[model samples]
Target: MRTRTARHAAVVAALLLTLGAPDVAAAPAPPPPDAAGTADAESAGAALVARRAALAAASRGGGASGLDFGACPAVEDLPSRVRCATLRVPLDYARPDGPQIFLTVSRAAATGARGAARQGALVQNPGGPGASGMHFPLVADLPGWERIAAAYDLVGYAPRGVGRSAPLSCRDPAARATGPVQEPVRPSPAYKMQRLAQARAYARGCARRAGAALPYYTTPNNARDLHVLRAALGEEKLTFLGASYGTYLGAVYATLYPRHVRRMVLDSAVDPDPRRVWYRNNLDQARGFEGRWRDFRAWVARHHSVYGLGTTPEAVQAGYERVRDAVARTPAGGTVGTGELRSAYLQAAYYDDVWPDRAAALAAFLRGDPSVLAAQAAPDPAAAAGAENATAVYTAVLCNDAPWPADWGTWDRDNTELARTAPFETWANAFLNLPCASWAVRAGRSPVAVGAQPERLPRTLVVAAERDGATPYAGAQELQRRLGAGASLVTETGAGSHGVVGGRNGCVDRHVERYLLTGGRPGGAGPPGAADYRALRAPRRWFVAPRLVAVHGEDVGSEESALGVS
Candidate 1:
């Protein structure tokens, strides 16, 4: 679910809100009391201490059987009602006493007793294989989510190797600084050699830094950890809402523990095909992004009077290429080159609301003002560690969960072919994942056979955006079919965004709310055999003014940064 470039760095930082301490094995030493910490750090530390205390208090009730929940330390912007706890689980399921890791869990309790009685807990994951879920409970404050919050405890947790868990830090700071930018369309042989060398070095860094824990970071293990958390929470069955990569995690959980699942909602789903585990999925993403770019071009064309970039899609595209060429010749802000330009504007593919901003930025750059480009290119010092942790976890999980071709030739041939059709992101995506070819840890097990036994699972709801660049719409349709009679597919027919749930589509949100709250699904109201669901053709304005869908009066924006599309 990795995005094309550094723009997603902001998203990872925003969503990596930590509510508890990192597991002892991987926790970093605390900064000196005199040292200034970001507000995010201070709040995360305080909440973690409080959560540990609560977990200790709960132990008195029944050891690990009853979770003694208590108020989280007051963090700015976090809902006052949310409670936090830390649950320790076996680092390796095969050896329960070998070592221990902790998962930080948060819950926004149901509003009333009756609502609480209907559904016990609604566990959630916000899609990054690396993204933190500590802040997820805050969604309870949103409009449509109030009913859900009233009906079930909104639960969120940081997965094993993510923030405030046993976080992984593998990349050398120097390596990251010197990392190669997106490759040119037709790079020289020397450039290929240089990137491959960097890829190998990166793989070595992970092996040296992550060491033992790297082997256990696969999706199945994360699913196993979910089961343990479920038991600790005293829930007989799991009810979950997972977006982006979270959807893949949910599917694996249902497949592994079908009977343990009570209900599930998967938005922006990953294709479960083993062959497309990651490498191929990224290739598919290349194609999706190309289409999304075309959409962006069309939008720019529509606003030609304002942007003055072009009056047609082709002209707009040409304008973009001109910018790329100019940046390549002389880097803007001394850092923003063609790669930076691509990364900055790629946001338009994820959410339509950003189209205007992106267009404005592009127009400014074309008009001899590179400030916008420079501002976007500047890296955030505060997000450095979180970004490293996310990159580590993302690589660990994807590399270890399934096999990748060890030969560079396979990648070269495949990427070359993909570039012929989907040039925007093919090379970038290929290089981003190149390290997997030389990953230190071998593929631990076969990719989870997702949708392997969908009939054995309970009723589930699947939502997808028609032109979603990250998780393409086809994957959602395929997942729905695999889930068979028990699953319903809700399509945002023309929406290009990656995340659909709670993104202000009343039609989609209502269906999600109904399914989660009352166990009611969209009936067979569409044409016969039409996936047993409805399709909402998003309004044109839906693309232009995404803020209209802000939840709880605050824009949830796009989760694309946190959850890489495919």
Candidate 2:
């Protein structure tokens, strides 16, 4: 996922065009890396040395025995049942004895009467390409989560370069302190040049600090690491739950190790098209989010008595624009600028549950109170290092997983054209991924071809919201089609939240629970709509105020925050 500052700007002219044009030609593959000289051989040698050092560090407490489980450090509100451990896997699978990296794994033991006969570990990932899953097991307390835990151990792990694992850091503290903080809106020729320079500098910093490890940070590698974790946990087959980018990772894992999968659930599935990898997905997201924002406007209009913004969607939108213009001219609370205002409201596109908070913030801003807006605009600086690490990992994985166009001309031409229709996030999304144009590492492999071969894979359940702005509903449909009969798609009709399961949607949760427990697939399947299932309604409070804070930290322009492309 791209950051908010880097992923939410727009091109005004493009906003006037039609939405949903047919697919464009796929991006051309990048040229192969230098492979004909001593330079190549020397580069290979250096990489091997670094890998060895990483392996040595990972081997500190255990040698080849896998993870060493123990009590986790006291995390204030983390569940008491959660246990933490670290597992070492080769940084490069081909070199088993080469460098190794540790993955921080957390587990919630099954608590049902059939605990001893538990199905196996259900590994979970919350996406972000960078989001940490260390606390995911704590969700066992949620309605459906406990049932899932009853059937199997809930396992969550921070992928190789995230959280308590051997994290990847690219930004020098000093550089980050002084670098450009926000992307320019409707970038001018000069702004584009400046962005290009920043992109190059960011790429160079990553290479300088983590180049040796960057190649190994691809999704394919992460999948391989998953298999290693599976083995370490003594599981014969992997049962998994992944959301957003996690869905993409799950797809890759299933494709590579089909028979190893037992039961899998992918929420907010990503389109597995190599061409769309990161860039095209963001374009799709721009259109999707615009639709979602319109939905928010309509919702706000319906409650005009409470908000007093407007009694019509257009009027509400105009009110928002007035505020946006004000911020552009003079920031709110001397901190929330035009960009921050956009970022603050962008969450409304992700989940409607936060609408009230967003509504309250907007009303407060209009009432001359910018505190909430300022808080959303400027995140706690103490969290900057962690946020940078997540961004670094996000960039490394995306840029290295598949070949991104190296030619600036391709990006310029494509984004310029896309801006014509999907204006809201076009420029920002382009800048979010701009670093790939000057990425220092060559892609480790071609994009994984994810398709279901039912004969080799087990039944899988795919969940998506009908109006998910980030991953978009179309990607879920495409993923279901690609996975063929091996997959069953469940859609939350009329809903726009990015992550659907475990959000107190009894209708969606029931299908998920049945699939994970009894392996009983939903019958008469076309695309099971959330409205079809009749069960208890989710608590009113759920939709009123879901946790606004993202699982990892400030998501900014990231897919986790806005696009769900991670």
Candidate 3:
């Protein structure tokens, strides 16, 4: 997922409202219909209450796991690695004794030298509903990560619907269609109609492809699975560090199993509200992009001579519109069409580290050279496989977790209004989520009311970016508000990326490292609004800002002008 250019517009989109809703009241679950539904709810409820009781009992007596690392498995293909037995859990908590699902578990032996077994096992997930965590011990090559990994017998698991665990694959023709893109959204009826149809089709396609499994793939269910994994690992209490969506998972775990937690770190946190899910979150994300866009515009204005688009920001914007209109009508090689533009634009928005390269690529393309832009824009086939799997699971779980408006008209009305204010990813994101329209399975419980104030919880660390478009900093504010004395929020003043874990802002990075290593969370309350926020150190300089500006919005930086053709 690495790229050289800023694709400033792309980053603006990716960084868009990354934070979750602050008021995380769980959606109301349907009232228990029959005795079976009632009984099942009670059982699930009992299991949760029992788990909490066990955690309390364990704390009083000793810890959760009584067994120590007795005998190690013989080393094989990957020496220093050992596979533990899978933890069997219900595919449907409603039928706890019915079809069973196995949770895959893997770990590296604690490095015996240097008194490295500092704490117990450190369980980690590398984000992505699709990213494989089974090999995290060997793959996480971060500078100081090894010390912790060596000492903690780093552990990882494949969540129910991904990797080595049972997976959901989508083979529908509708699912295979590339989603449409709409930016600087217009008032055309055609654009609106196409967007509505696409969303419904995508939801239906997933429901058909991923059957019964869809209902059980929710964040709360995943939290329950974590407890079962804890039992198998024989760890009395679980220690965790999650990034991006992983942060949302971690937050759910804390809320559901408050006592079983030994310690937790949520970086680039996701909001916990079910209603907001991915839909409303994208709206807040649009604003985040606007902020980064303004930052980029100022930077581009300063370096106008180098880019040569224009001297003032307004002129630079005119330049971008010219390229966008020209490319829409006549793309380079014809093959590199709007779809590729959309994908390339999305790729560029993922990081602040490469904005300059993206600007250069656009400038080159306008001047009749597309080699650099093509090289960066083309999709990686191997990564695409993982993207497909992750996206399918993401859709299935999201669609089943709650009912999106079945009425396309309602969606049309909502989106039309959204386009007026936040046109950046509104329509494009709506198309991406088209699958929910016809999801095969019925909806599950929406989130119930979550605590408005912090209660019994352990000290936790939260990392948030001021201008993150994906998970906005606002959710972090809510999380900080609820966490009270038990948590600390570290604001990355100048950066805009998802999750502050290891993306390389030293201030945020050091704060996260310290918390993970010594349970040290920096104390600070960030500014109230996104615009009022500041960067931790000097804001990191970016070259890719211009291209990112394209996807996020025209608000970031004015677009580059096309050079006159000979």
Candidate 4:
């Protein structure tokens, strides 16, 4: 579900929109002020407490009853390590005592310098809404995670319906295209019919396979589950580091259970407004991709001799358009279609480290190299299996949590408007989500509207970048305005990328680490404007190299600053 914005260091910041539940029907009531100080924090913490009791009750006796692990698991005759266990919760929170599912949990105890242990467990989530956090303590060395690892028994677990946890699987392989081959033909009966068919098939297939568990996969349930995990871990308060969707999860948890929170960090946040979750978030991602595209175009323009893309940004863009047009007319090898090309592009848009490789791949494909495009189209069995499970869970949770407009007319209008600007991904994205229109379950409670009001709660630190496209910088600003005194937003200037930590901005990481260790939030709360931020230029962009996709263009790259992570 992650969306690539700009090529920042490989920081975890992708904004992914997963499909699962139906629309929310009832909006939760806003909490009283003097509850939690600051609007954003107050709203978040309030929402959290409201669901704690219900979620806690659901955690007992569904499928994972009476399961517990005290210490790290020792797979071999090896040193003592983190422990692993399971906790059962209802598949549907509405029926807390009904059919239950097991959620996987893992913990790594602290081992500090001189053998001194850190205080509480610092739980971390990698933000796939699909990624596994079970190995967080093991894999936390990625870029900028070491600071927190030193002082806490790092903890993480897969959200229900995800990895290691009992998963939901999509049976249809046809649904797993790298991208959509079907394009919208304006005023065409065939296109409309095809859209309806694809939408219905995806929805029905998911409902048939996912069943009742769909209703229970919302973020609220996950927040509630964390409390059970907190209790099971013997910690009175929880500390957290959640990036991307994990940040949303963290925000929900804080909103629901203020007292249970010791310290928290929400990086690359989401729409605090529940109703706009799908709409605005997707728009943000589109803009991010466009911005990155422009950046790439400019970079390519500078190397005209090498790329043969003309010595201007406009020319580079024209060259890319030609490639896209070719892809649309004739799918590479008549099999590696335009859909595959778009998917490759989308993946490249995710990080700074892979920009060069993706650029190279696209270049090759444009240059008539069928194998390059074919390779992009090829699917790996393991990845496909994981994708099937991930997609099923994502769909089940999204469609079941809240209802989507079943009306094709509304979608048609919305997509038409969206495509006017975001032509690159608009239709393809619409097709990708066509299933939501026909999902089986009806909608649930509508998301609550949290107003800005201060109350009693621990001070929290929020991190975001100025140029961030996926989770726009404005979200952080609004969140800060809402939180007021109790929260602070540390704007990571110019740094771009999602889901990556500690790679691009030392200042940002130091700020986060200071807060985690000492409970201090960002200082010098500046006015919400462009002037308040600074830039942290990334050293690279991550993704597969772009193949030579254009027939008449020369190879690009060969620049000192061309797509390498520092």
Candidate 5:
């Protein structure tokens, strides 16, 4: 069913330069339960042994036997050397002798790595339990990614419930809610009730269609898959680079299997304060969006000559309201509505790269060219499909990961109050997550205790931007508080990009590369409390490669951020 809230948090899906599904392989049923845990564990252990051996052989350019090292499918934008294969893992680890699902894995085998040193397999996860990492390795094609690609076998995979793997779906075109935001929002009790019903219906629809597998779609399980991937790749310990929500996934993997993590880099760290796993994390996101929205408004105001919107933020906002009012009254080209326009604008808050195009698109409309507005506001169903799938997993993981406020009253009051200060993303975000109130799967499970015990975990490095509205800078600070005894925080000042490393800030990239390439301390990296080790700050300049700039008219300066691609 169509709904007022199609997908929220465009930032999650929008992160990596904007980045699907295969039908072929249905997972084979697990070995008979009569064979039980021990036998399955033994069998899995043996398979890992064989996989590790075959992977080692492949690494040395030896015969590729045992491992399914074949050419990757033609569909992906992968580096030439990248190979694709599949790994089977139990849907629920607790019951290993049960249903088994296949996870599509890709690898860019190391080339002439510097020092001829192969740092084992560098496993990656691009956030979203929905964000398919199948092509995350594609980021290797980016300018500065060459070194990491060469030093370690870059690995990407579709999380269990994403892509070719046992994908989840809750989409019902019939369930789509009608009408766009018709007027300036005046949130009333009746309006709240209407949205709440949409949220509930969406939740119910998910259960009706995909309820059976919802319980197992979680971060802990995701982390386990990484562990299995590590073993499959013949790595003694996992070398991981995760961004955004992937940071949370990595952290969980570390906590659950710390001894197995050789090296880990978490970019744009998520707030790990157990108290704010998701429910609170999202509210904080609204404020971040509000702040980014201001930056965008000011940018548009600055380009008043080009956009003809206004010369001040207030004037720019007035112009926005004009467009909003027009679309609310009459949908643009019979498709772009208040909701679509708002979602389109939401992209600006995610990345400044789109500000010019987005502003120009809206400006053309204000100038009586509704076609420009219509084209700008047109929905991408393909994107929407991926997002809804991601949303499906987002809800499943978030709802199953920890407890959310089950009472609508709490959500209503909190979001209503928050809207007073940050209206741009508040209610939209609330609706995005409101399904949790009626989630078919019960929550209340405590989130992983990330920094509670860092002894087993290696000294980790976290990169974050002061203005990253997606995860927020507070998360980095919080990570330090918890892992400070062993971790370092790289703070990118004055930047608002989501993830920090694929090819963003040189300073942050240097730190990450040095850490990954050289292993631990004596490699020029200091102790956890050392100057740069503890808190490394980036220069003010951004490096925007032409390919990274997708704005219309002029570019947002000659700078770009990383492909955090999570």
Candidate 6:
């Protein structure tokens, strides 16, 4: 394996060459010597307490801001008792009074506790740079989080350039959003060119549609807006729960406003190393996904008695390749492409809960049924629209935050090189972000130095699944290190799920719930020399098909099982 130092140096060099400027921010200073580190840890802990006290003193007797609360717009997933409202913030912080954009924010007020007992707001984000998190307050509805909901008002929002908050669009809303099957690559120069063209066209569309607001839709600005949301909600100190890309946002918020963080839970952390902000991060994801994909292949092989695809991992790969080749040769039902098939299976890599269904789909298709594959690829009009917007916002944020390799050659070279080793979805993901090479706006800003002032941060709980592809475990480790002695990592060992906290892992949830509720942390829960916790289990939901609805084994009425498994 390549050393992190070597990887860092290589990526930085590529970034400099491509951007024609130094975009990689310097990493924070190394950890102190053991004896000094111990002293520093003690002093940092003392400093944190004093800082919290000072902040509390400064904001004594402060109450809610004047922002009016109204009933949230009803959505399918949101529970009752949720309130929402819109707030306006500057489009660009540089010129605060220049232009204004609105943000939609939601909150589920504490139900378990009253005034003095309530623990302020517990804000959360659900990862997408493009994904809308307006319903994240729904975390309050989870099994172990009800108490947390009672103590802290669960807050959620649609960050700038996502959802109803000045949404970014790169296509004509009236134009049919073609849900084409853009498959994984095979090192073909022609396919490479097609992706480049598509990316360039996409870039052009964003430039024409996104207009001047494009440049400001960045991570730093997003962090600043979060602070504004904090003020609007009248929270003196922030208690954050962020997952996936959200982990990065929360980290940046802490970096800029460390004094304001009361508590933070970063689940499935993004690498804080500035050099890997995005370009390198995607490459890392390709490798990370490869490992999980193998796990999935192994699982399917174990269940060969049912699916009959293969009896071993290597055999499973052969089956997968055959299925992939079929999709490419003839788009399933003229709708699904090899790309769409690969994309669908990619979900299984993120979370194994989909494994049974995904494998079943493959089995059905291999048996001469294209309906299963075609249905999966078919686009729901509204979902497709939302996906398009997300792609737009995702592009804007990453491109604006840092410089990507300027030339198509760099992308082609890098991705093609990566596909050789990690072939699953390398080309698919590569083409997805290829627009960055031709982005409309250039913020010329480097990603924030998240760990620059480690001492100022509170004792944050950073969680990760050891085998998470989206936000790999190594990134979480790096994050904990940068967070200095105050941070304790709680990694779910051998678990490949992207985000695991509320996904039904008791051990992980116990640690998270205890921390969010009783100010607990996860130290000493890990094996010696490992992370603070080593979660060993994964969630598996297998609903055996039943012909009758039973009330404690007494049949009330006959009902067909939704899942086909009998």
Clashes of 4: 96
Instruction: For model 1, name the residue pairs that clash.
Output: 1-564, 470-565
Taken over the whole model, the C-alpha lDDT of each candidate is 0.70, 0.68, 0.56, 0.58, 0.69, 0.69
Candidate 1: tens digits of C-alpha lDDT, residues 1-566: 55423323333233321112212212122221211222567654663443333323332332334455677655323445778877776666545546777777888878764435556788888886898887777766555677887888888888998877887878755446643144475766688778889889888888888878878788877876776676667666688888888888888877766656777888888887777888888888889988998889998898898999989999988888887888777777777777777777777777666787788878998899988877876555567777888888888888888889999989988888888887887787888789999988763446766766533456677877778897887788777766655677777665677787773477778878887876666655343234332334444463353322211011111222211223
Instruction: Give the Cα RMSD of candidate 3.
Output: 11.6
After TM-score superposition, the amount by which residue 211's alpha carbon in candidate 3 deviates from its true location, in angstroms, is 2.0
Best of the candidates, lDDT: 1
TM-score of 3: 0.76
Give me the overall lDDT of model 5. Answer: 0.69
> How well does candidate 2 match the true structure in TM-score terms?
0.80
Question: Once superposed on the true structure, which residue ranges of model 6 sit more than 4 Å away at CA?
Answer: 1-63, 74-80, 113-116, 173-187, 524-566
* Tens digits of per-residue lDDT for model 2, 1-566: 75432221111111100001111111111111211112566665555444333333333333325566678866412445677888877777546667767788888878775444577788888888887777666666544566777878888888988976788987864455432134455778888888889899889988889867777788877876776677667665678888899999888877756656777888888888767787678778888888888888888888888988889988987877777777777777776676666776778888786787777777777888778767666645676777898888999888887677789889889888877766666777778788988888763546766773333345677887778888898898778767655566776666777787775356677777887886755644243222123223344452332222111011122112221223
Provide the lowest-lDDT 10-residue window in model 1. Answer: 548-557
TM-score against native, each model:
0.82, 0.80, 0.76, 0.77, 0.81, 0.81
Please write out the lDDT profile of model 5 over residues 1-566, one tens digit for every residue: 53312221222234443221111012122222212223367875554443333323223321122247678776654445678888877776555556677788888777755665676778888786588887665555566677877888878888988877788877754344444544237578888888789889888887887757777787867876676667667665678888889988887776655556667888888898889988999999999999988988987887888889999999999988888888888899888888888888888887766777888887888888889878877776556566667788888888878788888889988998999999988988888888888888763366777765434345566777778888898987887567544566667666676876765556667767776876432113333344432333444322221111110011111111111112
Worst 10 residues of 3 by lDDT: 549-558
lDDT tens readout by residue for model 3, 210-256: 67676777766676676656655556557887767777677766665
TM-score of 5: 0.81
Model 4 lDDT-worst window of ten: 16-25
